[model samples]
Target chain A: MIKTMKALIQREFWEHRGAFIKAPKIIGIVLLVTTLIAYITIRVTSAKVNGEAILQSGILELKDMSLENLILFWDGMFIGTSTLYFMVLFFVMYFFMLGSLYDDRKDGSILFWKSLPVSDAETVISKILTAILFVPIVYSLIYFVVLILLMIFYSIILLFHGLNPIELVWSPAQFIKGTLVMFSGTLIQAMWALPIYGWLMFCSAWFKKRPFIYSVIIPAIIAFSWYWFKVLTSLQFTNISVFKSPAVYLGHAMFPYSNDYMGFSGIQFNDDSEAQLSEILANLFASVQRMEILYGIIFAGILFSVSIWVRRYRNTT
Target chain B: MTQMITANNLSKSYGKFEALKNINLSIGKGKIVGLIGPNGAGKTTLLKAMLGLTKYTGDLEVMGVNPFKDRAKLMEDICFIADVAVLPKWISVDQVLDFVEQTHPKFSREKAEKFLKKTKLGKKQKVKEMSKGMIVQLHLSIVMAIEAKILVLDEPTLGLDIIYRKDFYDNLLNDYFDHERTIVITTHQVEEVEHILTDLLFIKDGEIVLDSDMEELTNQYFEVMVSNDNYDDAISFKPLSTRKIFGKHVMLFKNVNRGELEALGDVQRPGVADLFVALLREEEQS
Candidate 1:
C-alpha cells in the first residue's frame, strides 16, 4: 500500500508541475515587481515628506512595544502581502485542480488514471493533498524570499536618507517568526476552506455540465436550502429550538466569532502591561483546540467518499 | 482450469429499463476472447460490471474475487481501459512514464520507453499537444508496460485510422499477449480481430446469445452455396439463415454433415463479421 501510494503521489506531482511549478514563477515575477513598487513607494514618500517626527517619537520602539502596535504592524505587512500573493496563489493551485483533474474527466483523461493499478480514493486524495499542502508551502517560501528582498530595499532607502536606524533595521528572528506565522495561518485558512476543495472534486466527478458554474451554484443552492429549511422548521414547529442553538447559527458565517468574544472578557477590560507570555500562549492553544477542525475533516471525508463512489460507478460510455 | 470470470444470473437495470438481463458466463485464462455486439448491446456494461465499475445483481468474479466488492484486490491482476482515452493532460510523456513505473509493481519503464521511442510521440510532448491517435498510442504503450494477467480493452481502437488500427492489434498480439495473459476485447470491428480471437461471445440487448470456442463454432457451422434448383433441398438442412445471390442460394447451417453440405454446391467459412451480423439480424427478427 505504501509503495502504491508513493507512486500515486509521484504521478500527481508530475501531472501538476506545469500549473504548480511553472505558473508560480510567473506569479512570483508579478509579486516581486509589486513588492518592489510598494518598497519604493514608502521610500520615495518618506524622503519627500521627511516623516522623521513620526519615526522618532519612540513610536518605532524596538525595546518597548505595545500589543496594539504589534498587531497593526503585523496586519499591515502580512495581510497586504498575503492578499496579493493568495490571489495568485489560489489560481495557480486551484486552476490545476480544476483543469488537470476536472478537465481530465470531461476530456476523457480519467480513462488513463482509472486504467492503472490505482484506486479511485487514492487518486482523489492525492489531488486534495497537492492543493492543500504541497502547492501552498512551496509558493509561500518563494513569497517569503521576495518579501525579505523588498524589506531590505526599504531599509536601504531609510539608511541612505540618514533617518533613525532603529525603525528601519529588522531582526532576522522577527522575520523568521513572521514567516512562520504566515505559513501556519495560511495553512489554517486552507483547512477552513477544505469543503470547497472537496466540493470541487465532487463536482468534477458528478457533473457533465459546465463544472465551474456547478462548483459555485451547487454550494449556493445547498446553503440556501438549508437556511430556508431551518426557517420553515422554526415557523412550523414553533419551538425555534434549532435556530436557538449557538452551534448551528454560529457555524455559517465565514469566520468564527467565539474566539473574539472570549478575548473580550471582563478581565481584558483592565489593560495590564505585565501579563505573562505563557498565559497568552495558553489562551492561543485553547483557541486552536476549540477551532472546529473536526467539522472540516468530516466534511472533507463525506465529499471524498461521494466523489470516489461516483467515479467508481459512473457510466463512462 | 480456474475460472477468471463467472457471471451467474446477473442482471443490470437503469431506472425502468433493463440494460442486461440474466447473463451467465464463465471465462478462464489462456485464451483471447472477443466480445462482439451491436450498439446498445450491453458489451460495455458487462465489462464494467466485471471490473466493478457498474453495479449488478448476482455473482461475478475475476480471479476468484467479486469484481465489485474486491475491486482493489482484483485490480492487482486485472487492468481495464475504457473506450475513451483518459490521460492527465498537463504532464509530459517522460513524467507519465516515471509515474507509471513507480506506481505499478509490474510496470517496466524501460519497455515503455522502447515502445514510445518507436512511435511518433516523444518524451517531451504533452498529452494535450498530441493528436488523438498519438494519445491512443501513448495510452497503449503505458498499459502494455504493465504485466497484467487479465486485460480488458473496451473499444481500444475506436478512433484510429485503418493503418493505426491494424498496427494496434498487431502490436497487441505480438508484444503483449501470450498464454499466460487472458485478453477480452469488446469491439465492433470484428473482421480485424477475427484472426486472433480464440473464443467469440455475441451479446444482444445485454444478454449473451452465443458463447463458444472458435474451433467448435467453426466446426459446428458452415455456409453452403446451392443452385437455385436445389434451394428447397438446402431448406431441408434447417440452416441458420439463407441469402439469395445471383442465380444461387447461400445458406448458413449448424451441425450439418460435411458430405451433405458438399452435395449442395460449395461450402465456405463465414467470416466473424458476417456471423455477427447474421446473429444480430436473427435477434432483430425474433
Candidate 2:
C-alpha cells in the first residue's frame, strides 16, 4: 500500500509540477525583484535628502527601539509577506484540487491510470495529500527562500550606508524563528482547510462539467438558501455556514503577532514592552477549537470517501 | 485450459438504455479473441465490465477474482490499452517509464527501454510532441514490457494510419503474444485482426450474436455464389443473409454442409468482415 501510494504521489507531482513547484518559484522571484526595486527606490530617495545623515539616524533609531518593538516589526513583516504568498497559494490549490480528477477524465487519461495496479482510493487520497500537504510545504519552502533573499538584499542596502549588516537586519529579523512559525502556521492552515479541499476534490471527481461552479457556487447557494429559510421560517438550524467555516477559521488563525500590530501597513509598539513569543504561540494554537478540528476531520473524511467512491464507479464515457 | 474471464448472466444498464443484457462468456488463456460488433453493440461495455471499469449485475469474474471488487489485484496480472491516445499528453516518455516501474510490480524498465530504443521517440519528449504513430508505439512499448497474463485492447490503433495499424498488430503478435498470455481485442476493422484472432465473438444490440473459434466459425459458416437460375434453388437451403454482387447472388449460410452448398456456383469460407455484416443483417431482419 505504501509503495503504491508513493508512486501515486509521485505521479501527482509529475502532473502538477507547474502548480506545486514552478508557480511558487516564480512567485518567489517576483517578490525578490519587487523587494530589490523598492530598496533601490528608497536608497535613491534617501540619497537626495542627505543620505549620510538619514542612514545614521535610521541606524540610531533601530538601536534605540525596544526588543518588543523590534520583534513586532519583524513579525508584522513576516505576516505581510505570508499574506500575499498564501493568497496566491490559495488560488493555486483551489484550481488544482478542482481540476485534478476532472482533467484526467476529460483527456481520457483516467483509463490509463486505472489500468495500473493502483486502486481508486489510493489515487484519490494521493491527490488529496498533494493538495493539502505537498503544495503548502512547497509554497513554504519558496517563501523561506524569498525571505532569506530579502534579508540579504536589505543587508546589502544597510552595508552601503555604513551600518552593521548582522545587527541591523539579520539578528533583529529573527529569521530562524520566523521560518519555523511560517512552516507550523502553514500546517495548521492546511488542517483548518481540509473540508474545503475535500469538497473540491469531490466536485472534481463527480461533476462532468464546470467543476469550479459546482464546487463553489453549489455551496454558496446552499448557504444562501439556509439563510433565507431561517429568516422566513424563524428557525435556526445552525449559526455557522459550512461554506464560510474555512475562511472564518483562517481569518482567526492567521497573524499570530500582537493585536496592536493588526493593521496591514502601520506598526505601533510600546517602548517598555518585552517580546511575547510564547504568548503569540499560545494565541495561534488557541485560535482553533478542539471540537472544530474534530468536526473538520469528520467532514473531510466523509467527503473524501465519497470522492473515492465516485471515482470508482463513475464511468468515463 | 484456464478460463481468463467468465461472465454469466452479466447485465449492465444506463438509465433506461440497456448497454449489456445477460452476457455469458468464457474466454480461455492463450487465445487471441476478436470481439466484433457495430456501434452500440455492447462490445466496449463488455470490455469495460471485464476490466472492472463499470458496475454490472450478476456474476462476473476475471482471472478467478471478482473484478469489480478486486480490480487493483486483478490489474497486477492484467494490462489493457483502451485507446492509442489515452496516455497523458503532458508526461514525458521517461516519466512514463519511471511511473510504471514504480507502480507495476511486473513492469520491466529495461525491457521497455529496449523496445523504445528501436523508436525515434526521445526520452525527454512529452507525449504531446510525438506523432499519433509514435504515441501508439510508446504505449505499446510500455504495455509489452509488463509481464501480464491477460491483455485487452479496445480499438488500440484507432485514428492511426494503415502502416501504424499493421505495425501494431505485427508487433503484438511477434513481441508480445505467447502461449502463456491471452489477448482480447475489439476493433471496427475486422479484416485487420481476422488473421490474428483464434476466436471470434459477435455482439449486436446488447447480446452475443455469435461466438466461436476461428476454425469452427469457418467450418460452420460458408458463403456460396449462385447464378440467376440457381438462386431459387440456393434459397431453399435458408441462407442467413444474401446480397447481389455482379449479377450473381451471394448467400451466407450457418451450419450448412459444404458438400450440399458446393452444388452452387462457388462456395468458400466467408471473410470475418463479411460474416459480421451478414450476422448483423440477420439480426436486424429477424
Candidate 3:
C-alpha cells in the first residue's frame, strides 16, 4: 500500500511539475515585487512622518514601527495571491488527475497501466490523494517560503528605521494559528469535494467524447433541475409550514439571498486575540459538520467503483 | 488444471446489434493464440470483453478471477498493449518508467531501462516528441518491464514500419515471452505472426468461425494449384475458394491429402493468409 501510494505520488508529480513550477513562478514574482515596493514606499513615508510628527496627527502608524501591521499587510497579500493560486492549482490538479485517465482511456494508454500489478482501487485512491493532499501541500510550501521572506524583509525595514526588530517582527504565533485554522478547514472541505472528483473519474470511464463538458454539464443539470423544482414548489407553497420551520429559519431566514450556510451562530472576528484556539477548534468542528465528509467519501467510492467496472468492461478496440 | 483465460457463453450487444454471439473460449497456460478477422469481425470486441472493457452477458475468468469483479487483482497478473499509441503525450519515457516502477509490484526499472536501451527510446524524450514508431516502442518497453503471466497485444504492429514491426515481435518473443506466460495477439498481419502462434481463432461478424491448433489446421488443409488443363478436374475436390493467376487456378481445400491431390495438381502448404481466406470463405457459405 505504501509503495502504491508512493508510485501514485511520483507519477502525479512527474506529469505535473512543469505546470506547477511555471504557474507559481510568475505569480510568486509579481507578489514578491509588489510587496517589496509597498515596503519601500511605506518606509520612506514613515521616515518623513517621524521628522514632522507635529504636522501629522496620526503620525504614520504601521508605515513606521509596527511588525504586526507589516505582517497583516503581508497576510493581505497572501489572501489575494494564494487563494487565486491555489484555486488555479486545484482546478489544474483536477484536470490532470481526471484528464490523464480520460486521455489514457480515449487513446488506449490505460491498457498499459491496467495491465500492471496495480489495482483499480489504487489508481482511484492515488488521484484522490493528489487532489486532496499533494497539490495543495506543494503550493502551500511555495507560498509559505515567499511569506517568510516578506516577514523577514519587513523586520529589517523596521530595524533600519530605528525601531526594535523584535517588536517589528510578524507574530509567528498568529501566523501559525491562522495557518492551522485554514489547513484544517480546507482539508475537511476537500472531503466534501470528493464527489466532484469521483464524478470526474466516473466520467473518465463512461464518456468517450467531451468528458469534461459532460461531467460538469450532466451533474450541474441534475443538481440544478432538482434545485429549480424545489424553488418552483417553494414559491407556489409560500404558506407551507416546513419553509417557516426553525431548521429552514436557521438555514435561510437570516441570509435569504446569500449562500452562506453557516447560519449565524454569533461568531465574531477581530484578530489573533479574537480567534482563540478553543473557538477556532469549535468553528473547525462546525465547518466539518457542513462538509458531510463521510457521505462524500461514499459518493466518491460509488463513482470510482463504477469507473473501475467501466474500465474493466470497456471496449478496447 | 487452471486455464490461463476463459470466456463462457460470452455475448455482447450494442442496442440491437450483437457484437459477440455466444462465444465460449478457453486458452490453457503457455499457449500463444492468434485472433484473426477482417474489418468489423469483432476481434477487438472479444479482446475487450476478455479484459472486462465492455459489458457482456457472460462468465469470463482470467486465472480464476472474473475480470469485471476482480479487476484490480486481475490486472496484477495481466498486461495489455492496445493497438494505438496510448502513452500520455505529457510524459517522458523516464516518467512513465518511474510510474510503472512505483505502481507495479512486479515492475522492474532495470528491465525497463534495458528494454528502452535495446529499443533505442531515449528516457528524456517526451512521448509527444517521439515519432509513431517510437511511441509504440516506448509502450512496449513499459509493458514488457512488468512480470505479467497473461499478456494481450491488440494489433501491436499496426501502422509500424517493417523493421519496428519485426523488432516489436522479436522483443515479445525473445525478451518478454516464456512458456509460463500466455499471449493472445489480434492482428490483420497474420503471415507475420503465423510462425509464433500455437493456436488460431478466427472471428467473423462477432462469432468464432474457426478455432484450431496450428499443426492440426495445417494437416487438415492443403493449397492446390491447377493448370487450366486440369482446373476442371480440381473443381471436384470442393475447393474452399479459387482464383485464376497466370492462366492457372489456385485453390485451398480441407480434408485433402497430398497423395490424393497429386492426381490432379501441384500440392503445397497454404500461407496463413490463404488459410484465413479459406476459413472466411467457409464461414460466408455456412
Candidate No. with top DockQ:
2
* Positional deviation of residue B68's Cα in model 2 after best superposition, in angstroms: 0.9
Query: B70-186, model 3: which lDDT tens digit per residue?
Result: 666777688888765777777898788777776677878898888788766776989889888899888888788888888998898899889999988888899988898999999
**How far in Å is the alpha carbon of A128 misplaced in model 2?**
2.2
Model 2 residue A223 lDDT? 78
> Candidate 1: RMSD over Cα atoms?
5.5
- Per-model TM against the reference: 0.81, 0.90, 0.82
Error of 3 at B247 (Å): 3.3
How are the candidates ranked when ordered by TM-score, highest leading?
2, 3, 1
| Cα lDDT of model 3 by residue, A9-39, tens digit | 7777776776655666666677768867765
Candidate 1 TM-score, C-alpha based: 0.81
The DockQ figures for the candidates are 0.44, 0.77, 0.56
For every model in order, the TM-score on chain A comes to 0.68, 0.84, 0.72
| Candidate closer to the true structure by lDDT (higher is better), 1 or 3 | 3
- After superposition, the stretches of candidate 3 with alpha carbons farther than 4 Å from their true spots are A18-26, A37-86, A89-101, A155-165, A171-173, A195-208, A211-286, A289-317, B1-3, B263-265
Question: Which candidate order results from sorting by DockQ in descending order?
Answer: 2, 3, 1
What's the lDDT for residue B180 in model 2?
91
Docking class of 3: medium
Per residue, candidate 1 scores C-alpha lDDT tens digits across A11-80 of 7667666666666566657756775676566555665676654343222242244444544454346545
